[model samples]
Target: MAYLIGILITIIILLLGYIGVIEMQIRSMSEQLERRLKAHTRQNISVQLVSKNLNQLVICINKCLKAEENLRLKSMQEEKQFKEMIANISHDLRTPLTAIQGYQQLLEKGELSEEQRKRLAVARKHSEELKGLIDHFFEYAYLLNTQPEIKLKRINLTGLVTDCLIASITSFEEANKPLEFEETAPVYVEADEEMVTRIVQNLIRNSVEHSEGTIKVEVLSNKEGILRFINPVREPEKIDIQRLFERFYSGDEARSRMGGLGLSIVKLLAEQMKGNVTAEIKGDLLEIKVTLPLAQ
Candidate 1:
């Protein structure tokens, strides 16, 4: 009986040891799985920094993929819409051009009175306006499709502002809008020359077209490089300030048909040049501030 009890005790000891070994193996496998998962996350694109992060990482990635598919679909729809818009615009333009040609033929063949010639000139001017509208449409479309390449250089901000002002005079005159610029020292910063110029010009035009009161452009040296565009609002603006960079967004309902690529293109170019854009309202003034990193 003592031998039997001893054999039983031996068997119990062996069972405990076997159990311990199994548990250890399980623990090692768990640690290995964790390590591999972390490594895989580091290599993958879909991983997001969530605190409950591991579990949700896969979910976030899936969501991102879904969102990307949606965006591609949306872009496809926009392409189709643009094609229709172009066809309609082309048809509208041809009507005016045809009228101008008919009038020109009549003027050339007959002794038209002064009044008739004047009316023909007016018709020609309206036809030119139609052409101008088409040209503007093409400009926006081109800017939308073009990829920006930033060429960094040290530029004089004040001088750039001066040049932009000079270019805008004629544009403002045609729009029956007055433009004013406030200046400061020649602040130097690193940016793409062409892009900066375009940004300033667009902002100026947008402000002029949308503002009810006088427009003010102030170039001040702030942290790095800052350009501020300010204008007094006549009508309260309904636009979400956060959405100012969206394409075809305009504050005034009446001006919506002017159909601009101005702010949208400016935003894109600014980002490509490693700059930032933001807008705000102070009292009756609508202010847009753009900041760029200074040249080392």
Candidate 2:
């Protein structure tokens, strides 16, 4: 009876020993599998387990590895296709659009009656709008498909905002619109100057087109660095705040006149610079806010 008890105890010890060895092997395999997946290597995780339970775990892990590999391959293929489509749109479409603009300019130079000249001017206007639309499409496509190189530096927020506002003032003046800028203390942020310039330009363009009354630009130093554009609109209900930043989303008939890439580009560029943008509508006021990380 004692001998049989000893034999049973030895079998139990061996069984526990086998489980410990299997656990160690599984831990090592898991670490190796993680490294391979992170390196994006085309390698399957394999394990040799004598026990049934461990073998089942190995099978589950292998299935996950296969699924991960398939997802990675599919993402690569989709990205490649997107780039090719953008290339085709840029080359094939823009070339002819450029030619059309050139001919339109040449036609403007020729002599014509007053009515004909006015009609030609309208044609020229629409042509210019079309050109802008095409450019917007190209820019949106590029921003979507590729990561733009951003040169980060300490930018003077007050100075940058002032310059962008000044550049846009002429357009507002020509439209017989009153534009206001409330000066703020100089604040700095880490940002790419060119990209920030684009962000400001797009925001101002949207205001020039849609804003009705006083257009105000201000820089606020708060929890985050904020550049705000406040403008008065005729009716606030016409604007869809939620969909304003979405690509090709024009909330109203007036906004539909635009190519609808302005706000989308602003959002993309802002995020790349470690910033974000938001819009608020209160009463007839439409305020667009761009917030950036303050320079440390």
Best by lDDT: 2
Looking at model 1, residue 204 earns an lDDT score of 79
* TM-score, model 1 to reference: 0.62
Tens digits of per-residue lDDT, candidate 1, 137-192, equal 55555555565566899999889988888877887787666677766778888998
How far off is residue 125 in model 2, in Å? 1.2
> How well does each candidate superpose onto the true structure, as a TM-score?
0.62, 0.74
lDDT of each: 0.72, 0.84
Candidate 2 local accuracy as lDDT?
A: 0.84
Clashes of each: 0, 0
Over the stretch 1-296, how does candidate 2's per-residue lDDT look in tens digits? 99999999999999999888888888878788888868967676667667677678877878987898789889999978876786577667788888887987888889888998898889888877877777777887888777888899989888998998888778898877788887778989889999989888888888888888888888988877899999988678978899989877887766677658789999999999989999999999999999998887
Q: Which pairs clash (backbone N, Cα, C closer than 3 Å) in model 1?
A: none
